[model samples]
Target: MSTVIEIDRLSKSYVVPVRGAGVRASIVSLVKRKTRTVEAVKEISLSVEAGEVVGFLGPNGAGKTTTLKMLSGLLHPTGGTASVLGFEPWKRNNDFLRQITLVMGQRNQLIWDIPVIDSFDRNRVIYRLTREEYRERLDELVELLELGELLSKPVRNLSLGERMKCEVAAALLHHPRILFLDEPTLGLDVSMQRRLRTFVEQYNKRTGATVLLTSHYMADVEALCPRVVVIHHGELLFDGKLADLVRKFSAQKTLVLELEESQEDLSRFGQVVSQEGSRATLRVPKQDTAEVTARILRELKVQDLNVADPPIDEIIDQVFSRGMA
Candidate 1:
């Protein structure tokens, strides 16, 4: 695959005015101001290939949004360089903008009183799509997102989930080759989140658009991205396969056991995470997983048992904690 997104020491920063409380202090600060420089994105370099779905993972204020904004040509970087589709992102060229799209979960680009399809039409015009192309793409998005019923409804009348579906469709109306999704599933119910994830997967497969997604929901990352890039404090921490991240940082394994009898204490084998009628979940050291599994089978009445890696979120937490340390 060809490299579509190439970032070399990309960085961003901000300067903000500082002020203190009290009328006297505020008046005195009118003439002489205090200011500080905040680094939103430290020097970070990464390369993404065409048609790849890579997860961008970081906590709040970790510069995930800042990086995406810079890459989408919405913000100017303080230092370094980035090239998306062989165009400098901060330059905001029309050719570059036409080939990429950014969907922010917390923000909306649709007009409030207009119907969802009207908003999509607005984007269709902005991207200069022909009537037939617009209709074909709209139909495909409507079927994939199940937006046939919601399109004619006013944007104000739609619920958060419904509006989010429309927002994604509007962003993709032009069939951009690159997608920057920042928390696209935020504030949605479990079913809605799953639906959006499925739609994104289908869109990528159908269009072959490269995706750089930043989501707090681990399920989104696990489902869509084979590779993940972790950033903390505006610095790169890890960039590798999802399974490699788990293997490198995670120290524990999870064992799920189905007991023939209920209410049995299994603390001697490992740390009991949870237990219910005839079933228990344990967290055991990775090194001791095999031995504990055998011992549990030897001692307890086990109808069924399974061993698996710890949850992805837990492994990610470990990654951030260790990186901060």
Candidate 2:
């Protein structure tokens, strides 16, 4: 696979004004001009291959958006280098801009008062697409996104989910080779989010567009991306497959048992995570799970037993709580 996105020591920093609580101190500081340096994105290196859908995972204020902005030529980096599709991103080459699209879930690029088709037409003019190309691409997007009646309605009248679908359709009118999505499914309902994910996966399949997506929703990451780059405090933490992340961060498996009798304790078998009546959940070391299950069945009342890995959210939470230790 060819490398579509590359970064070496890419970083962005900001100097924020510092103000004291007291009025006198605030006045004094205004004259003195005190500021502190903040590293929104540390020196992070990344490489993305063509036709790959990768997840950019991080908590809020973790520099996910900052990095995306630099990659899309919307923000100039304070230091280091980045190349997208063989062009420097900060230079904002017209050809480079035409081949990339950035979509923020909470932000809208569509005209609120205009019908969705009009906004798409605006994109058509901006990208310098001919009428025939625009019509073909628009037809394809409308079909893929199921934007039949929705295109005739004004953007302000559409629901959040509908508006998002339109936003995606508008962004894809130019058939960008690279797509940057920041929180694309942030506030939608579960069903809407799933639909958007499915659409994106299909688009990538048909067009082979390279995508770098950032989202707080784990479901979006799991559904659409096979590889994930985890970041925290503006630094890269892990860059690998999602399954590798689970294995690296998750130390235990889950064991659930339904006892024949109510109110019985099974603490001796493993770490009891939750106990309610005859049903109890246990956390056992991965290597010791089989042993613990055998002991539980042999020593305790035989009943229904279930074994599985712990939830992905819990494992991720543990990693964040530990702070990259």
Candidate 3:
């Protein structure tokens, strides 16, 4: 596959005013302005090939949104370079804008009072899609997103999930080759989230569009993105397969043991995380899990035992905590 998105040492920063409390400080800040530069993205570099789906993962304030904004030409970068389909994103060129679509979870670009199809039509005009092409794309989206019944209804009457479906359809009306989805499944229930994931997977498979998605939900990343790039504290921490991230960040495995008696202290074997009645959970180093489990089974009259990887959320927490430390 050809390279579709290339980011080289891309960085973004904002000079924010630091205002002190009380009247005198506020007055002083207005004139002189105590400002601090917050680095949102710090020399991050990555590349995406055509027809690839990559997940951009980070915690709140981790610069994920800032990076996406820069990619979509919503914000200018402070340093480094980015090229999407050989066009600089900050230039906001019509050719660059027309080949890419950005959907922010919290921000809706649809007209609330208008019908969903009308909003899509508005995008058709904006993208200058030919009538036949527009109709063909619209029909496909309607069928895929199940938007037939909801298209005629005003956006305000639709539920949040319903509106989101329309929002995605609107963004894709032009059939952009690249899609940037930031928390696309935000505020959605489990079934709706799954449905949206399925739709995204299908769309990518059918159109071979390159996608960059940022989501808080691990399930979303796991389901839709085989490759993940993780950023924290304005810096790139890990960029690889999700399984590799877990393997690298998580040095310990969780062992759940069902004991014949609840009186034994298992802290000697490892860090006992939780214990309830006859069931206890312990975090043991990966290398020691096998030895510890064997010892526990022989000595503690263990009824049942299971070993598993640490949750992705915990691994992420560890990564960020270490970064902070």
Candidate 4:
């Protein structure tokens, strides 16, 4: 597949003013302001292939939003180059703009007082879609998102999930070749989150559009993105398959055991993560899990035991925590 997005040594920085503490210092600063530079996105480089769903993962203030803004032409880079769909994103050319769409979770593009279908119609006009094409796409989106009941309702009246579906449908009206989704599933209930994920998967499969998504929700990353690029402290930490990340970051597996007695101390067996009455969870080194399990079985009256990988959340927490330390 061809490279749909290319970023080389991309970096973005912001100059924020510094305020002095005392009145005299504040007056001096006002006269000759002191500004500090924050490197929002350090020299980072990555690419996305056409028809690929790539997840961009990071903690807050980790440059995920800054990088997304740069890629979508909302903000220009301080250095380096980026090309999306064979055109420069910063230029914001008409053709390039028409071929791409950005959906931010906390931001709304729909008219607040107007009905959602009215907003969709407005997008049809903005994209200059033909009547036939507009109707066909609208019908498809309405059916796919189950927006028939919500379309006629004003955007303000709709629930968060309802409004999000409308927002996504609005972005897809023009059938853009590239989609930039920033925290698209934020603040949603589990069922709603799953619905949105299913819709995204279906949309990608049907349209074959290239998608770059940045989200804090691990579930979103695991379900939608086979490949992920992890960034921390304005640096690219990992870029590979999700499974590879799990294997690399998680050096140990979790063992949950149900003990026949409630008083046995299992801390000596491994790192005891949690204990409640007769049940206990331990983190054992991957290499010594077998030997440790055998020992536990022989030494204690083990009623039931199960071994599994550590939670992805814990692994990611360890990665960032260790990096900061």
Q: Candidate 2, residues 158-232: lDDT per residue as tens digits?
A: 999999999999999999999999999989999999999999999999999999999998889999999999889
Runs of candidate 2 with Cα error greater than 4 angstroms are 258-262, 276-278, 301-304
| Candidate 1 local lDDT, residue 235 | 96
lDDT of each: 0.94, 0.93, 0.92, 0.93
Candidate 4 structure quality by residue, lDDT tens digits, 182-240: 99999888998999999999999999998899999999999999999989989999999
Candidate 1, residues 1-325, lDDT tens digits: the string is 9999999899998999888999988998899998999999999999999999999999999999999999999999999989999999888999999999999999999999988888988998899999999999999988999899998999999999999999999999999999999999999999999999999999999989999999999999999999999889999888999999888888999999999999888999999999999999999999999999999999999999999999999988887877843
Candidate 1: lDDT over CA atoms? Answer: 0.94
> What are the per-model C-alpha RMSD values against the true structure?
1.5, 1.6, 2.1, 1.7
Q: Which stretches of candidate 3 lie over 4 Å from their true place?
A: 258-268, 275-279, 300-304
TM-score of each: 0.95, 0.95, 0.92, 0.95
Native-referenced Cα lDDT, model 4: 0.93
Off by over 4 Å in 4: 259-262, 301-303
Candidate 4 lDDT for residue 87: 88
Q: Which residue pairs in model 2 clash with each other?
A: none
Q: For model 3, state the Cα shift of residue 29 in Å.
A: 2.8
Instruction: Encode model 3's per-residue lDDT on 114-150: one tens digit a residue.
Output: 8888888889899999999999999999999999999
